[model samples]
Target: MADIEVFVFAVEAELEAMDRERVGVHRRGRKPDLALRRRLVGLVWTLTFGGMQWRVAGWLSGIPFTTLHSAFARWARLGLWRRLGQRLALDWRLACGDEVLPSAVVVDSRSLRSAPSAWARGIDGGKLIKGVKALAVCDKHGSLLDLELYPANTDDRAGALPLLSRLAALGFQGDLLGDSGFKGAPFATAALAHDIHVSVSPGGTRDGCFLPSGIRWVVERLFAWLSRYRRLNIVYDRAPDLFAAHIWIAMISIISRRLVAQTHT
Candidate 1:
């Protein structure tokens, strides 16, 4: 993985250029200096891979515990990370010569074990993990279009409802490919309600052998990529939105490196 500072610096120009468009509020505190802003943003990068303790991350990043914590939560509540991820994902796709809008998307979810302090968790009977569930919607190339996080106990079909609505809001109207876990009338009906077509992969193993299911497996690969971030390997965020924000941070980190590499090449 590349250093956090490198990714922060790489993204500085784009971040500066993108309109703040702050949602609801005339701020009280003065704006942060450029150096402080970089440190604050870099803390978000540290958050991507490190354990969820703000104090630990603060000490490691040479930032104050309360300062980093407040900034992170504020950014998440303000939807900065979400917009940043969306824009960067689009930039990456455009850089690679892909369309502005993806006609089809792959969706998948994984259960991660939550910490004792985690309040929002449920038992996923099949995975048997008592934690949160992450629903990642991605284009065929594995760039995340959007992400949803909730209790692990939520089944594939049921968990997909919010994801479908969010995708619909984002103007996605195409095939939603998934595993057989999502194959059923309920999910298909829900997806169709959003103008999305449901396409499920084959159910069960063939001769007890595992075979990758076409483009649906792209989301599986996306989970693999997310797993590399230590913090994401386990669920520790008190709020699902915070966990989702960290995920966006991780994704933007990945996109930053790719974009920077492309520039150098």
Candidate 2:
């Protein structure tokens, strides 16, 4: 089998066993055509690693650019990629001792330049932070718990708590560390509900001095890992769904690699 086949197999098995909801079925059937799946995998991997345009991804995958783009949007909206992420996170939890809570969980967001079109406007038109942002949360052990993407214009504070709430539901409770942008009552309230303490890096304030900014480095490293895939390094997707899939798939890839690393070690 091809590498994509292997990836899909591993992902499919995990999702089949773990996901509470199923992806919407295509009229063609539940399992996508093998050729189509391979192409989708190739496109995602290429974007993940190459950071190329869909036209370029088309050339690489030998599928039409539009076809490649459509598949990505479809799968992303269906939450197939999110299911993969959840499975990877669960696998990491299983591999690590379930009783050992991480000493720290890091939170951060980074932006990427998105497609320039009418649709990419407003909250969709990623903000001024340089590009669209992928807000990520990860434990000190480098296991990613949750991630969210917003137009660069979206403030980090606006989207951080929802992911935190999801993480708390998933059993992540510990001191939460982030940059200065994350300091606020909403964050504090959410963290309090989960019994998690908040720490923020102080750029030049007394509160900054007390915040555990050093520990926030772990989340930065998590983003670094996700950025290793070229497609994610740039926001090349035309739709938010496609863009989110790139993030989700890159995350799954990172966790899968980590799982392998642990087994070897």
Candidate 3:
């Protein structure tokens, strides 16, 4: 089966496992059938992967434009994408015989140029990019644990604390691995506030590519995987949360396939 087919099937399974209220699918009125609902889900993936615009989803799906886009935006606002990402991360860990809560998290940021339509664009003097920064936290196996997006000018140490705190709220207790950008005592002290110890990967990479001793590089791989989704290459959406929602969707698409592939392997 195609990867998206697997992803859709996995999403359907998750929907089945969930209560109707939790998944946000109501049975009132002229509800779309299973096949139609599946198509709607696929249409959502299409809209996300295509990055055309939200208004086009109705034209693509033959559903009312407002209805289509509102549902999509509402899910993001309601935190469905975030919830799905966390659930899949847990399932991925279990499939790979790993723990549900990661023992170690690798955090990093990427700067991408924003489109003229995007908001709060800033310059990252370090990366020299005129855009926003995406802060990502992933486990040793490269599953996304949490994420945040903000203006590129924001300091990495400052932007990452909230993500770590979110994990900590979920009972996460682990070492935080990162590049030297996260090495300062201020950031370490801040991370310790959440009970997550800090461990920066050794000195500058001025010598060459810094090959760490552990899974620090795995988060880079996660970033690379996210880069493949055409929707994520640039910040086109006006709302940063919507853009972040796409990131979660991309991870769901990738991780769901891994789950399916494991069954065959």
What TM-score does each of the candidates earn? 0.90, 0.76, 0.90
How many clashing pairs does model 2 include?
A: 14
Off by over 4 Å in 2: 1-9, 12-22, 28-31, 98-104, 118-129, 203-214, 261-265
lDDT tens string, model 1, 39-78?
8787777767765578887787778988888877876787
Of the candidates shown, which would achieve the greatest lDDT relative to the real structure? 3
What tens-digit string does per-residue lDDT give for candidate 2 at 131-195? 57778887766666678777677778887867767877767677888877889887788778877
How should the candidates be ordered by TM-score, best one leading? Answer: 1, 3, 2
RMSD of each: 2.4, 4.5, 2.3
RMSD of 2: 4.5
In model 1, the runs with Cα more than 4 Å from the true position are: 1-3, 10-29, 60-62, 203-209
**Quality of model 2 by C-alpha lDDT:** 0.68
